[model samples]
Target: MKFQDYKVTDINLADWGQKEINIAETEMPGLMALRKEYSSSQPLKGANIVGCLHMTIQTAVLIETLIALGASVRWSSCNIFSTQDHAAAAIASKNIPVFAWKGETEEEYNWCIEKTLSGSDTWAPNLMIDDGGDLTKIVHEKYPGLL
Candidate 1:
């Protein structure tokens, strides 16, 4: 896991993150219900899900859903500039490992993707949820077995 090569601020933005998470939760009733019902079932109990998407209300819904379904998630921004810092905060507030933020430098963007893939070393995702296909491509090229 090249995680050591990446530099994350690792600071707490709790209040800001909480606000975004709350708002996303309100808009995602369907995913939320899935979380409530299936969480205990643990259908995805040992699964790992690495998602590359914009940090937004919709993405928050998806990540929380996957977690509730018993999957460990590593989230990253798809487009470098599209990440909403507040939304990233929201996801991070829940203590879901997120590796993206607004106005990230190119190095940060690549590093985040590297971190997401690193989580797969132990157990590759059974399924990947991606917005722009960057994560998918990386998995294919670097760890084709996941595909």
Candidate 2:
């Protein structure tokens, strides 16, 4: 999608992560089925989504599914240690604005979460998906107007 900004542990790991994402995709029936049914319809067209969850192979697959459904997204990890650099690489490789890595400090974790809320002037994220409450809390606390 050629996003203008993103942060990840390493772009070089994208190839390895893409392989993992490919494997995961094959195993996810529901998402694949949904993709097949909805890609052309693009029910999510013009939706802007921001997400905070564990960055993993599963998440990578889900991210792609969301894209296939036509939502533009920005994403981050909810927990510092829960991030998978390779998965982040895979997501970022698509030029999706993903901000995350493994083992972030408190500052970096917050920074990553904050980043997902940006591009508001351009993207205007209308949907938010978060594993823990952090992402949702941040939005309410710092970006109340978004609601």
Candidate 3:
């Protein structure tokens, strides 16, 4: 995706989030190893992953690892309060669409989920990763063709 494609809380928070995401990367050896091992082969090269989870430093690490292993991703927070704006910004800075922020109403939360599930003209997800059932539920109820 292009750099201008995402809708995060703030693009300016990228530097702040990058430092933490860097620290988190150091603490995640398993993913690092996987990235080193499989990145060249790019087993997930064709993957278009839609992820709905808590947006945090840890989540950023996972998403980046997925990218390193060759998966294009879109993301959203499962809960309104669980999203870290800086983290969302960081992901979006790398041209990965991440729709989330620190606070949201029920409607906003659902909207973010829908954004991850159904992105801009350039994105069409072929896989999904969900924390709670909201993503799955919405796919079944709304975008049944994704099934």
lDDT of 3: 0.89
- Give one digit per residue, the lDDT tens place, for model 3 in 18-121: 99999998999998899999989999998999999999999999999999988999899888899888998998888888899988889988988888887667
Which segments of candidate 1 are over 4 A away from where they belong? 1-10
For every model shown, what is its TM-score relative to the native structure?
0.81, 0.95, 0.94
In order, the Cα lDDT scores of the candidates are: 0.74, 0.92, 0.89
lDDT of 3 at 60: 98
How would the candidate models be sorted by lDDT, starting from the highest?
A: 2, 3, 1
Task: After the best TM-score superposition of candidate 2, give how far the Cα of residue 19 lies from its true spot, in angstroms.
Answer: 0.2
Better of 1 and 2 by lDDT: 2
How badly does each model clash, as a count of residue pairs?
2, 0, 0
* Ranking 1 against 3 by TM-score, winner: 3
- Worst 10-residue stretch by lDDT in candidate 3? 1-10
lDDT per residue for candidate 1 within 77-134, as digits (tens), equals: 8988887676676666566778887778878887788787775346556777788888
- Candidate 3 local lDDT, residue 27: 95
| Better model by TM-score: candidate 2 vs candidate 3 | 2
Q: Is candidate 1 or 3 superior in lDDT?
A: 3
Alpha-carbon deviation at 62 in model 3, angstroms = 0.7
